[model samples]
Target chain A: MKNFYKIVAVVGLTMTLVPSLLFYFDVIEIGQMKLYMAVGTVLWFSGAIPWLGQKRTQN
Target chain B: MADKSSILKRLDSLYEFDREPVTRNKLQGIGNFLGMYAGEHVAGTEFVIGMLFVAHGVSVRDMFIGGLIGNILAIGSWAFLTAPIAVKVRLSLYWQLKKICGSMLVFIYNIVNALMFCFLAGAMVAVAATAVGIPFGIEMPALSDMLPNSVGWVVTVLGVGTVITAMAILGFDALARFAKVAAPWMFLIFVTAAIAVLPKLGVTPGAGNFWEVARESIWTGVAREGQSQFSFWHVVFFTWLANAAMHLGMSDLTILRYAKKWQYGFSSAVGMFLGHYVAWIASGILYAAANSDAPGVVAYEAIGIAGAICVVIAGWTTANPTLYRAGMALQVASGWSRWKVTLLAGAITTTAAMFPALVMKLLDFVALYGLVLIPMGAVILADFYFIPKLGLQSFYAEKKKIDFNLAAGATWFIMLALALFLNLYFKIELFFLPAPIWILSLGAYLLFSKMYQKNLKLNLT
Candidate 1:
């Protein structure tokens, strides 16, 4: 379960970052970049909240 | 369900080790310190400060080089000055100060410290309010605006302040959790916004004209109308002086006290390089693209709604901890419950948030905050190291059960006077005064302590 959420977080973060990079290279429209970022924000929050809310293995 | 009293007690203990040294078992690792400094530094103020660097006309070369050197000095101060003392003493700044300065003086210091924290938090609230106001068509305050400009502005500020204060009163755990998630995302948002806007600013990745465009349009080295000019030295000093209160003024004693070793102080580099250096540069780029000093306007222009939300969350995260610290300081002075004092702090912060000058003049305000608090840090340093070497008693007030250490009090006041003299008479900028004033504070404290201890010995005999 933790791994699942971790993967979700990774994908969400990648979504957030990649669109901007693509946009910079003229691969994605600004509109699509914003849309991807917005979705990534939601996914990232859902995954990260539960993942980080748990106790850490180390301090 | 737990009753109200139990809940309040739980909330009160959420932040432990206020009046006592952190226990050995509770010592945090370097990872914790790294995450903390990294998260805490990339905050709402970064948006304002980064943009202000552009408005003040800092050339790209000067800002890059000077900021690099300044950040290095800041990290050194934390590692060498603040952390070692914190590791050895393992006491909060307030507790250590009470012993050295005595309870009466600490009480006075607490009031000043708490008020400064309130004003600083108020500025963050104002930044958040700008973002919150955007969708509602509320007019943003001009850079020159000092007073509350509109009913919408007042309403927005109050609304933002209330949410931040309420979250602060709830406890640190929730805020910590939120911050952990928000920090990375917000930092990325800064990166994304800057990158997305670079093309708009005439900077193409492979064009080999990035520096030319940056120098021509971005860090143009020409001040905006009504803004003060800045050079390499100003950039360097401002970068160093921004967090002088934490490193030089020794306020981080409270935070670093949790670390297992002094070396963990070097973890502050993660914050300096990423938040202060990278984040500042990115936001400066966004500012150049947006051509506005208002955080929300610039952010919204760069990346739309995500940018606005970033502004809001960044502001809230920064203001929450600031208000919490303010309440803690006020609790020491007022003898009230943490939540109760936090409520009072929230009121003060909200009121200050109504005034846009607090945010507009944030650079000067931050410098003033450091100047006011740094003398006590000097006293602590001198008492910890130099006073013992000179055969003068250390922590003299605690040793003698004195209500107020006359020497420490005199040093604080005299430094303030010296700061005033330098600023008015010599026209020295506040950003340039901390180093000289810090050295003067050390000497003044030692001289006064010698006189004080001599009188005390005579009275004892």
Candidate 2:
């Protein structure tokens, strides 16, 4: 459970910070910036997989 | 302890004997928290907030910086203040408060909290109705619209409200599941819609001129005619305090109490930055394109069907949890079944949605609602932390078997009055009052409790 939280925190934080950096460094186009953000969001949600799966197992 | 046993027995009965008790599990709890926050944040309100920043004339630097800083503070408040207490108590705010301030006082506070939530959910229903109404050739309300102008609007609002209410009534699991499903997709729509329209607004890709056009054309920090202008401070403060009632006000104690650690609160950044920041910027760009001199519709009109649909969904995503919370508030106050009260609250929200006023005045309404509820949070914080350190008993009402705890009651009222006085007498902005009100309520509770305890000579032990 603790490990799952750490994964969520790391993934969530990285997803949030990475886009801001990419946009700042001019490494991505504005369109691609948004696309990268969307992908990052997917990863953040993916991190929640462990958490959501836990509920099913407990039930 | 006689008082404590009776309340505990009643709470046990309310949950039914067979149900499992809430436990701190990091994964499941974080999943629920992430979904609820992300779904709620990304949906409906994004459209309104995006348009609002544009209306306020927020500079590009201010919008980016202000949004980032403000959301960080909001996330921090949730992580540090709300989550720790939630995990420690492992109880809903309503049940916990009954042990602290007594049933009578909590009853009154719960009613007010529920109504504020209903109205907020109504605003989201209004947003969704606008999108549904588009295909029906239903007239959409303006930025300043207040009243229900037509039957089509009323019917659409009721329809949307019904769906939102049904989802809310299914309880926490459903809410979490729905949020998770919606958060990612809704986020995509926001991004796609914004990107699709950037070129229409005369912004080009991969050119120095594109960034220049973004600054001048897309995020020009200029308000259209008839809209009230917002400054950097207003944008920053509004974003910071938008969920003031939930995070800073400790409302999420109900949700976060299941977390294994306070850090689960940091999961809110997903909702805040992704939904609030990125989505907000996207919607603002869409709104900018929609603005034209001819102006048959507002900036949202230019984005056509797609923009309007996003606005409606955004409203729903945010409003569903708000309405669900309101339903819980009503259940606490009325002692009615949670499902039933939630349904009733849904009806009220739907009715409120028929009138465009709530959505139109969302900025002001959010500030006012936060102001009203924040004092209770301050009282809770003081009673929880300060009373023990000051050598006063916490949960004095439960400890003493009192029906009404005057110390907590007085703090609630006095803090509200002081906040109102600041807004009216000192002519202070509404956004600025929560901090002082929080401090004042804390001090008032401590002083009032000491005096009350002295007079009653209550046996805290």
Model number with the top lDDT: 1
Question: Taking the tens digit of each residue's C-alpha lDDT, what string does model 1 give over B359-383?
Answer: 8888889889988998998999999
Q: lDDT for every model?
A: 0.87, 0.72
- Please give the distance, in angstroms, between residue B29's alpha carbon in candidate 2 and its true position after superposition: 6.6
Q: How well does candidate 1 score on lDDT at residue B58?
A: 95
True contacts kept of each: 0.53, 0.00
List the per-model TM-score of the A chain. Answer: 0.86, 0.53
TM-score each candidate: 0.94, 0.79
lDDT of 2: 0.72
Q: Which pairs of residues collide in model 1?
A: none
- Show where candidate 2 strays beyond 4 Å: A1-59, B1-32, B162-176, B291-309, B331-340, B458-461
Candidate 2 on B98-118: residue-level lDDT in tens?
Answer: 778887777677678889989
DockQ score, prediction 1: 0.56
